[model samples]
Target: MQKTCLAFAVVALLQPALNLWASDASLAVFEKRILPILQASKPSSCTECHLSGVELKDYIFPEQDKTFAALVKADMIDLKQPEQSKLLKFIERRPEKPSLITDKVRVEEAAAFREWIVAAVKDPQLLKAKSTASVGPQVSDELIRHARKDRVLNSFAENVWSEVGRCAACHSPDKNQAQVKKFGNRVSWIKPRDMQGTMQNLLDSGIIDVDAPEKSLLLAKPLMQVEHGGGQKMLLGDRTYKQFRAFIDDYVAVVKGTYKDAKALPKLSQEVSQVSEIWLKIEGIPKSLDKQFLRADVYAKTADGWSKERVATGDRAIFGGGGLWQQHLTLTAPRDSARAKELLSAQKLAGGEYLVRISIDRNNRLAQDPNSDFTKEDVIGEVPVRTNWPSGYGAMTVVKLPAQTR
Candidate 1:
């Protein structure tokens, strides 16, 4: 009787068909957030490193759903405590049990991935949930279908042209609008003549980091996370970054020999969409931050004048040059977790008249704080904004310096 009951519980967790996808949302979350990291992990060769000699990839998870269930059951994932997971701990570089993989996940990418894991773990069934849809075309399905080397370049040509055109703009012989010549000789991603050779060179030349694709110079140069003479061209959290990450997946696949020039890779998609989310594109600030960068002291006006909570802050220049700057922020609230609901409620109460404040930090020491009257050093702007925003919707707001009043 005891053995039978134990077997039944095991069967429930491993209930193949029903447990696999859970829903489109879960599948989407897994495909976008988890798949890239997993593909980079070399699960087929997990036994090479572990003392137990356990292979956790195809051996254990023959299918997508099984992998999802296995992650949850093995205590490798947790919704409530995402950062403190066994899987992350194993891969995190530290003095103890350092990750053996030459390639490791970036800190920002890891944090973003946790959001996806929590979403999948919390709601196995994504019903009543508004799973997200990106602003650009959804390629989650298309990627798995045509992830081969040659075909990948075609699919990538479509997606890459849309996202990384900035790279092509400066690097290509045709579009070197900036006349940036030094990199032109090393390799040209613009021409189609020697794509395999060019890409292989790009991959091997240290432009693309296999372990942390997000940290690759291909991405970092455009993102402003690292210094670029061009200044910041791409905002970190925008649709552009997401699209580029998607391309990285295929690039990694091709590099790792999982997909070749002729055959198609599996049409796998992982989603990391949040429930309540909003995007902010604040423009019209001086780009020449002679001393300090732009910072928005986010606040909500409650019944008692203003809410004490600091909703969100801004950093980095999305578009910077000629002494002018712009910033984009994606604000999200994941249901009842933390301050998500509070932000959602504040957004719901918003009127055509400004409900939030966007203050600029002109100096390194000056206070752009929303707590007190920002009449002195802080130049603030208020825009009539809407909230509880759809997946990829961004509020296009302007900032006029030296705001007239509080």
Candidate 2:
């Protein structure tokens, strides 16, 4: 009878489909087969790491290249003889004898994976496979389809040229205009060409950081009162500053191939009919998205007054705005996990009127920070959004909420 019972217990422990068993039944097997091998115990409760009590649902395993799920899908573990399973190989290799676990007593644990698996398979409280906590962030199917190299560039281009960040200004389209004009409409009055010379000049002078957007002087030129042709200081205001930042973002994106090419640019902005969730779309950029550099900031407001968050800060400047870049921010109740359960407790927010301020040092690296020379109290009209990026490159976006949701 004893040999028969031991065989039955081992069979149950090794079975693939059985993840949990009754606590009492699991304890019965643990007392007989696994108790003598333990070396030391852990401070963590026995059930925390064991299958009989808490199971593995609450625990998060380390990011493994080949996760247990893939292993199960590959049919590597045998359910009938769990002690002889490959999964048990890992547990048994622990530095303890007889018992597979290293922890000592007072913290009675699942000594071997065989013991744990047997308990898990029989436990009625074990979570279903779908409920495992090891899942990664969820991405939409549409976004996945658009992730092709060409489609990513297209989306980037569309986002750039919209009313948010108008690139056609300095980059003109044969619009007849006057020769040399004032600071406000210079791009509108001029033509577009390779800025390599301009950038090189700044780089040689140690103004811009080499190949880094956060330290580039080209990003800081437009927002200042620097000597253009005359000795006079010319100023680019808040609105112009933002548009210029958006332009650099596009320039970097296109150069990097985050935008597919000039041809795919227009199709990048095709508007969608519906928005079910927060949708982030990029298109028309070429392949080299990470090589270029740029910076942008996004801010939001709540009833408590003001709060801000940095949206993107990296070497790749793939995202651009149409001047009207729409960011759908969902503000949930503070740390209220129960808000999802209580319908009335959930706080819903639509778009609200906010401010977006951007500043750029177009000299590729000439102007020092506006705050350094000017008084800190005197809000320098150029880049009022107080976030730092590489020298010469900086951007800020202030969005206002719509009066009412549709």
Candidate 3:
């Protein structure tokens, strides 16, 4: 009986300290990181979902909301076991699975918040918000020296050069954009215009870990395994992550002096033709005799949103110094014959419907301007193709377009 009383007394002594620590977490990490994601605007009314559980007749508007938010913070923001939080799982939802919360709570927005969540749980001082005074993780000069000497890293960077534009928005030094600078080497890989310099900086600064490439900050920051001022930019099991892993693997091989060129490697023959071949034919395009007309880029609506996943790029619709002309192109789309059946199991439909957006570059400049895309308003015309039951390859799917487009 004496021992039981002693235990109760000990618990009583610790309770107040626990409450104070929780209050700090609520004020610092909850307010600074998690709240923004919780408060993110939705496409429709949020009144139904974002409301307090407590019933009160005299409750105010946002004050009540704040009270509810505090309840969530208390429940969801556990300092002892951060990863097991139901709130985290609710946000990291998959499309095929039933979502705990609506898509309004973007998982991408959780990257920075998660970093704070993990850090603040362990150390209350880490709850402080990032500021201009905030400093980045320090890298070693020796690591940079060795990474620079690796020729495989060079080749890997060469392959990524074409796709460098994808990283420009968050990784550049432009004042208008967030200046995420990489240390070592004068060249700035962050620059959208300079891929080689960007690669040099990326390697020199240690974003691509040669030792364990998958753990590299390059992949982790974008994937949100690590703290990124930018939110989650890439999904874990997607093509983009796979691509980064492949390149980083090659870079590691180079770092260890065991690098082998991918082109020189033996080919593995596999009959894995999974995508539906699309036959796109562009006809009735007028080409001015004096003007140089260029090619067209085709974008299709895939499982990922409409703008993402470029399906094809057509040949020059109308060549330079030519009259009205036509061209044939083949595009490939993910084979969804089975999944389409499941999506519309009850209600019958022909095939999967997709909206294909086509943007033509009249000048063939190929977007010389760093800031512009091939299908910019100042450059050319756009055409839309709505395909419900798209025919197979060489089926001659025709996309008709107007002469002028605003």
Q: Estimate each model's TM-score.
A: 0.31, 0.20, 0.29
Q: In terms of lDDT, which candidate is strongest?
A: 1
- Where in model 1 is the C-alpha error above 4 Å? 1-146, 149-159, 177-184, 192-206, 223-227, 253-406
Question: Residues 51-70, candidate 1, lDDT per residue (tens digit)?
Answer: 12122332123234565455
> Residue by residue across 231-345, what tens digits does model 2's lDDT show?
2111222222333343445434433434443444322211211111232222332333222222222334447644443222111122333212222222222222343233223
* Model 3 lDDT tens row, 257-355: 342333432222111111123345555555442233344455655577554544444333343233433333323233443432332122211344344
- Of the candidates numbered 1 and 2, which has the greater TM-score value? 1
lDDT scores for all predictions? 0.48, 0.32, 0.45
Cα RMSD of all models vs. native, in order, equals 20.5, 21.9, 20.9
For candidate 2, what is the total of clashing residue pairs? Answer: 75
lDDT score, residue 385, model 2?
A: 35
10 residues in a row with least lDDT, candidate 3: 52-61
Query: What lDDT is reached at residue 308 by model 3?
Result: 54
Better of 1 and 3 by lDDT: 1
